[model samples]
Target: MSHLPAVTLNNGVAIPQVGFGVFQIPDAETQATVSTALEIGYRSIDTAAVYGNETGVGRAVAASGLLRDELFVTTKLWITDLGRTSARDALHASLDRLALDRVDLYLIHWPAPATDAYLEAWQGLEELYAEGLTRAIGVSNFLPEHLDRVVALGGTVPAVNQIELHPALRNRETAAAGAAHGVATEAWSPLAQGGALLAEAPVVAAARAHGVTPAQVVLRWHLQQGHIVIPKSATPSRIAANLDVFGFELTAAESAAIDALDRDGRIGPHPATFHG
Candidate 1:
């Protein structure tokens, strides 16, 4: 089995540096695909209430026969569930679908500044954390200002801040802001939704130099920069290939070259304006 490295979060909980994501993965295909990933050595599985595949993820994990402690599962609360009571109820609903007693990490899916209740939602996460329903809690797609609000509201500092990150859309500012508060940055669209950054000249050059795929090169860049990355793939070969990045290293020049590819090209919805 491949030994994936782990990064300790602010709360002293360790998370696998590389995780498997199931975004937009059809519900019907989720079980088999996630089971294949587990068979390929992916211990961390990320899903969300919005994904509509939490039950599939639950089924795969249960069927994997891996010890509950051996796997790290994460899920998120949706926008509609954005207050203390509703957030707690939403978490219970998600847990029912996941069929797990407790998720390793539960995150607030979005700040939804328009609703202006993320702080209240965050307090609900705090209650979950205190109640031991989740080991750790964090937020996703939160900008610096949102984090600042958390700081002002006085709650547990988020252990992770998941955001859309890739070479072409390096969110250094948000990552740095999270880092300032000891929140580990986790990349959601780590491969730029798979293939856009893989074709970039710098990424291609690094891949050739490393004798690996461009996707591997980009994942290595994220790891080298100390960010947690989850690259999603339903294809068996590509799933295995994505985790094969541990064998090589990216040089400083090569890393910088890929960094230079940043053009503020964000491929996902902007957190500032995305209400859903």
Candidate 2:
């Protein structure tokens, strides 16, 4: 059995706190990579239609021999596929690619304020949730204002707000907003792609002190802070090590040092302006 702790969503669907992400991995390689993650005890898989790898993810899931109930799969609706009817059709296409009848969680990939269609897309998600097409629905890369607007619509509150959160970019405001509305905060690039952030003094010191890698230290910090993290890696060792963070705990001082590293370092597009 997977030992990773579960984070209950606002709708009470349980998601693994440390899930596997298939962001940049090519479609041709996703099946083997995701299969490795599954073999390593990762029960959660995060994918997107734009990733162009849902078919590979589906292949891996089919070959794993693990029961469907043993896995938690998540996918997103691309900006171009916004709107009530289109969103439903988009999810249908995604389900066809994933070879599943329904996804565990479906998210609006971006606010795309330029299109102003996220609200309508959210309406579609509500319909999907009601129809059992997805167990839960949420958004990604949403700012505080966008989240507020979604909540104001008086539909189902988002179950999660997946964002680019790392030691360099805490995204405290958005996270706090989600918390106030009972939406769970999920960190996408939790390690900041592992360059300077991993080499920083605090991260290195914590790693040395705990006999873990800097990546593990950072993942542990995120877990202790109660943020669900989906860290992606193609290397077998790193993929396995990423999920091996539960064995150690970081001291308050260590966590605080990482917290102080936040410098508004956003690595992705601002949700306010991004159209796609």
Top-lDDT structure, candidate number: 2
**lDDT tens string, model 1, 232-263?**
99899999999888899999999999999998
Q: RMSD to native for every prediction?
A: 1.1, 0.8
| Model 2 accuracy (lDDT, Cα) | 0.95
Candidate with maximal TM-score = 2
Q: Write down the TM-score of every candidate.
A: 0.98, 0.99
Q: Could you tally the backbone clashes for each prediction?
A: 0, 0
Scored against the true structure, residue 197 in model 1 reaches a CA lDDT of: 74
lDDT against the true structure, each candidate: 0.93, 0.95
lDDT of 1: 0.93
TM-score of predicted structure 2? 0.99
Give the poorly placed runs of model 2, Cα more than 4 Å off.
none
lDDT of 2 by residue, 228-264 (tens): 9999999999999999998889999999999999999
What candidate 1 gets wrong by more than 4 Å, as runs, is none
